[model samples]
Target: MFLLEKLFGGKSSAKVNAIKMLPAAYAEMVGDAGHCQLKRLHPALGVFELHFSTANGEKYACQMTACVAGVDIVFAANNRSVLVSPPFSLAKLRPVFDIALADR
Candidate 1:
């Protein structure tokens, strides 16, 4: 089992976790925008690259980290403000980021 699966649980792949966690974190950071894309960073270490466009034609990208507690979630983008209590049902995981761009 991957570290993410152990931490986040469910049948989530690393990429899927990246996608799901990204939106959650982004929502906390930028508010509801309806569309966004989060790229994965290799050697993930619970971190991801976030790219998002707001409804007002603004775009931003940043690095994000994910933290899962015993039913508690504290992500990097939220600055620990948006409290996310887990027992979350994960769906899938895939590689959304360009691994080639990941640092060695």
Candidate 2:
């Protein structure tokens, strides 16, 4: 598994655009009780997420989770649960990211 950074060098507008969409994403996520992955004061699934549109044109994302257990990786786009890792470092998050991105 690899990051988009390994495939595409330099930043692009899509990345920026996706970052810009986060507020909407969070609002949409938290607005719906079924979609909300939050638990108490902390988000149960993730905080920072990278949105991606797959080859088939599906909206997907790999989110970085910070829960009581510790930091982990989560695939939580469109309220889908593709993958969730045990407490792992940022380096390990990349591989899980690749899996999440490719699932579509």
Candidate 3:
């Protein structure tokens, strides 16, 4: 089994758990309802878009890529973006950021 599947129950579970693991700050950015969601663009690509809730009407778009090296996270807003590596954990919960029953 893949590490994520073993750590989480399966691919579905991994995706849900990953969305649950979204940083609190990011979750807050997603807005109250309807605005927070995880969209899978392809097998290896996923997108997390959150409402900006600012006067400018800009939005926060987070992109996640599943790669051999691990998942790559990029947060883009207002034409600017920053790369964020998944947090390290001794426990088995690595990120499987994808769409599904995901809460992202």
Against the reference, the lDDT scores of all candidates come to 0.48, 0.36, 0.38
Q: Tell me each candidate's TM-score.
A: 0.48, 0.25, 0.31
Against the true structure, candidate 2 reaches a TM-score of 0.25
Model 3: what TM-score?
Answer: 0.31
A best-first ranking of the candidates according to their lDDT comes to 1, 3, 2
Candidate No. with top TM-score:
1
lDDT of 1 by residue, 33-102 (tens): 5345757754336666667666977766667565565556555453322334433332211122222113
Cα-based RMSD of candidate 3: 9.2
- List model 2 lDDT by residue over 32-87, tens digit each: 32121222211222245555543345565455432221222234443443333443
Considering TM-score, where higher is better, how would the candidates rank from best to worst? 1, 3, 2
lDDT of model 1 at position 69: 55
Q: Is candidate 2 or candidate 3 better by lDDT?
A: 3
Worst 10 residues of 2 by lDDT: 33-42
Candidate 3: residue 87 Cα off by (Å): 10
Q: What's the distance in Å from true for residue 96, model 1?
A: 20
